[model samples]
Target: MTINGDGIDNPYGKVFNQTYPGRVILSESTSRTSFAITVLQSTGMASDKMAPLLQMTLSHMSFALYNGLAGPITIFGPSSENCDEARDPILITDWGHRSAFQEWERELTGNPIRPQMNSILINVIIDHILVGIGQRYHVVRHADPKNETKFPASENGNYWIRTVPAEGCKGSEDGNELDERQGFLRYEPEEKNKPQLGNNFSWWAFGEQPLWLNFSEPTIMLLDEKKEWPGDYVIIPAENRDRWVYLVITAPKTNELGNNRTFISLAHPLHLHGHDFALLAQGNDSSQIDDPDNSVVLKFDNPPRRDVALIPAGGYLIVAFKADNPGSWLFHCHIAWHASSGLALQIMEREEDLRKTMTLEKLQQVNDGCKKWNEWFADTENLWSQNATLFQDDSGV
Candidate 1:
């Protein structure tokens, strides 16, 4: 491996063949960002065998970089399958970062900084949705127990808190009848909508035995509206086309019962399908929740827009997007583990319009797909049965 346009010999006058070892600094200047690295395989091996081997390493390096994981040092080699010998050099080019915000500003507005004005502000709290056995431990029934700020209690005496499960019936591992409830991470409106506690309610519990047990079907939860049940998925309706929608996603600080002093915060890389959103602000200040509009700085002038954004641990992220796309889009956590464990929701934008566009042929295709999946699921070998070999461990994202 060698830096393009650089001398083959080392700075110490040592003639290095096939490899050059040195520090290559990428300056902050935009012009200095674009550069090339050439890799040459000195071995006279068959191109077919060497190309795949070298490509495998390159692919792994690229995957590591994409996932923000530690990767191998910058290096490359020539292994083109078309080429017979290793004489052919492979040149890898680095295209410097493309400034989307800057370009958008230059094209639309001359000002670089502008405040974002939105029509609707939606606050979404993202955190661990945990459900546990109500009989095993005591669930906090109030946000402020000392102040007597009692949360609406479910039928089984458990509080309708965001951190613990609501009351309901659950089957124990020993086949004994036990009561279950909604856990942390549920739609807030459900707490008030159905204040009357019921006994038949059940919810998904994470990290428990009978791994596949307590699975909940996906449902969309709408803001400002009464939810039919707790833990329903969220839906964002586009009543007007191209309306600005602001989302304030927060990851509240959580504490366990045994260790109430230590707060648990986790990072979530959230991804939104069908549209790009501007990241207005993100930080570790929970106080901004009181006055999100005034306290948090909003970026309007061509702010960075992307499908995926990170919600920092014990912090919040503000994003805004236009509700122009007419489809059911999934807004979910990018982390595989979290997403699988039910850290996801659906956004039904312009459901009426989307339904209008779904023709008979499209509907048939969807029905066929569902039929195939059901057929596959019905196969005893595919399901978790007494003689079944396969078991579902992760949330089928």
Candidate 2:
């Protein structure tokens, strides 16, 4: 891959790739550092199955790490833990440790251990190194006079939405909320609301199976604040396709019902499938943009744009994206398990326009694929089925 810096518009005098390689303090390669990751095998409760023991252990451990610490890359926003200067690399020491990692360990292994060290190395071989000069970029708000648009503060009508984490029940007996199973839990709020934790609760929009393939009945629904939360489905009207929509995801200390099931807040690297969003604001504390006392400051103009942005543990993230794409787009936590457990939602923009773009051939292809999948799933000899019970335990995405 070729790297160049000639296209940069250096306004501020900050370090950047002005020529080719950015200013390099050292050009020589250092000795390789190697490390080993030791996995501890342990026996679980009597009811724990050996088949899923390893997978569960790894999943929980991975969640613990991701939910506990921040990385060296700087996050865009005004916050205590984030670097003072945007684009600057955060110190490894500044990535503080949270007790949540140990909490997860103790719950899984019956013991808590010290935090493990982590690092990544990229090796590129070259005879000589070239350095570039520094460039500058200023942070400007949408209403600022320095901004090209010079939009008025009143015109900055950023559409705001919030979500909270909660534990949900997959199935229950006798319509009892207390008898609900603990297998299905959501790490992020489903859509704009918590997934109903009840016996009657099915996946909010698509039920138990995938819905995108069912083109005949595309899920088209708008956010409703009255009746219930829109679980995994939200519609963006065609008129607002050009407007900027903002979403604020905060790691609350408690669930929607004010319950303490999730005692510690976890981190999530939120990702949007269809489009890159501007990370307008973020903070170390769990605060929303609408919070009256929230000290988090938002940068509306030329904010750092990204497809994946980190939501720090016990913190908040505010992102904005134009609803120009007319299709069903997924916005969810980057963690695989977290997403499968329902920490995701679909943003169906301009439903009518999106439907018009779907061709009959594409619809037939999707239906054909679904038909084959259904047949495979129902086959008696399929490995996914055992004793007439589907072996798939997690939410069938």
Candidate 3:
């Protein structure tokens, strides 16, 4: 089918940093309507252990979120994460564990991951539905991951994903051209040969974090159109407006060695430049694929209306939103790097916005300039689908 823009025009380096098994889907949760959120943190494995540590936890959580969200997603951690703050740093559990048994880990793995996590373990299961579109917003944290003992302080604030502002102080009519707005300032890595600055003063130790994600407020909830919800084979919006709509997402797993791609999910608050949506289904989960009623039949004619939908790593999701606003607006993963690596896409009126922003003549000219974009995209996307160096029997990964 027509997947969201990927590869050249939008090459996805990795799905939230893991080797994407496939296009991330926002399906509806079946068992009960709820949000399946998986929150995890890894102590530094060693000095300069950022890469390996992140890899280990991401893969672990991706798989956990994928599986956990099939049911309810519960997490135990410092109080920094809100159980349902919608934009807080971390997620709290539903029930509070007052004892010394790393209650948070218990909520996640049904057991404690550590022996000394004695904070009040909370238990939280999504009690809602999985629905709506999640417009990707960027998050530019206000602090550092290593400095803060809690989240948020650890999380830089939201940084909405936007195009490079017009040049030479353009768009003066819409906005002042000579404006000294540093926020809209764009940086080009290519200028300096696109140097990889991870440890420089300009670069950060745990730098290059996402500056946006899951920040859509007026979200249109996608429901199970077939009347079957979380029980259906996959999650999606309901056919009519008579079923569950809200949904919470979780991450899928990858292997530390098998899938080394970075899948870091930084929550970015979405600040729509144009409009907003009605917040519906908040947090919930879906049914297992094997369930008889867990099948989602989509209706493109009347898709669910939403703007932002969190693409949890572990599980599949489905959401719908009406294309009301008219402009060359951005629709990305909210994670800047994710967007930069190919998770970015655009939703515009083919004729009104797209054409206005890029006239057919100019659009054609641009495409002509890069005629081979689509072709190269396919091959790059399918690179890991089937590795090439293997023998006949071992032809693919």
lDDT of each: 0.38, 0.39, 0.26
| Weakest lDDT window of 10 consecutive positions for candidate 2 | 49-58
lDDT of 2 by residue, 1-397 (tens): 1221123222222112332122212111122212121211111111111111111111122232233212121113324343334333211110112232332233322242223312111122112321110101223223323333454432344322221112331212233322112122222344111223433222212123211212122243222124432332333333476888788777764432222122235556676655667888877777554578756788977897666677766778889878777766666564434444445666666666766766777667656755665676555686422573423322322
> Where is model 1 more than 4 Å wrong at Cα?
1-238, 254-263, 291-294, 384-395
TM-score for candidate 3: 0.24
Q: Which scores greater on TM-score, model 1 or model 2?
A: 2
In the range 294-396, model 1's lDDT, one tens digit per residue, is: 5877788888655567776667888977877677665666443344434566566776677677777876755565566557655666543467343333333
Please provide, for model 3 over 190-281, each residue's C-alpha lDDT reduced to its tens digit, 9 standing for 90 to 100.
20012122321111011222111121100111111333322111112222222232222333333121121343332222212222333332
> Please, what is the TM-score per model?
0.42, 0.44, 0.24
**Which runs in model 3 stand beyond 4 Å of their true positions?**
1-260, 264-293, 296-306, 335-343, 351-353, 357-397
By TM-score rank, best first, the candidates go 2, 1, 3
Model 3 residue 389 distance off true place after TM-score fit, in angstroms: 34
What lDDT is reached at residue 150 by model 3?
Answer: 48
Which consecutive 10 residues in model 3 have the weakest lDDT in total? 47-56
